[model samples]
Target: LWLPGMGAAYATAAPADPVPWRAILASWTASHVAHAVDAAAERLQADGKRAHSSQRLTQARLRQTLQRAESARTVRERRSGERQRLLAAHAAWREETHQP
Candidate 1:
């Protein structure tokens, strides 16, 4: 007989018969091992999910950094163009006035 919540088995025998101790012990051991395996599988599945989530978060952060870098590059290019235009206008004015 298997006991609930005890993970053990018991056998009854008459005086002329011997209890099947080996079979009872084997069944109990198998049951405990199966439970342990199931628990380990559940933990691995949970860890996998966490790892996948972390990878997605890292990817999103990388994309954001790239976008910020691109924006800064565009701003720098625009400022450089403006500076060139201002210098050209100043040179033209100096030529018209013959300031050299």
Candidate 2:
């Protein structure tokens, strides 16, 4: 008998000899089970790889975000310092001009 998907043929015994139906069934079942296990293992491996890649991408994005935030904070601090210096100078100039 020809097994579909296996591409192999199984021959039956001569008319006088009994056919080994149990052996044929067992072999077919084992082949199908093994195929299923292999397929499951491959899927798990692929999923693990995808998860690892996603984790790396997330870490990179987080690092970039932190760097941008740090840069922005530095700029703000510098602007604040400049504003304070300008205000102090303006106050000094006003006091000198108003002195009688």
Clashes of each: 0, 0
Tell me the tens digit of each residue's lDDT in model 1 across 1-100.
5555333354432334365655566667777899999999999999999999999999999999999999999999999999999999999999999977
The digit string of per-residue lDDT tens for model 2 on 30-57 reads 8788999999999999999999999999
Residue 75, model 1: lDDT of 99
What lDDT does each candidate get? 0.79, 0.78
Candidate with maximal lDDT = 1
- Which residue pairs collide, candidate 1? none
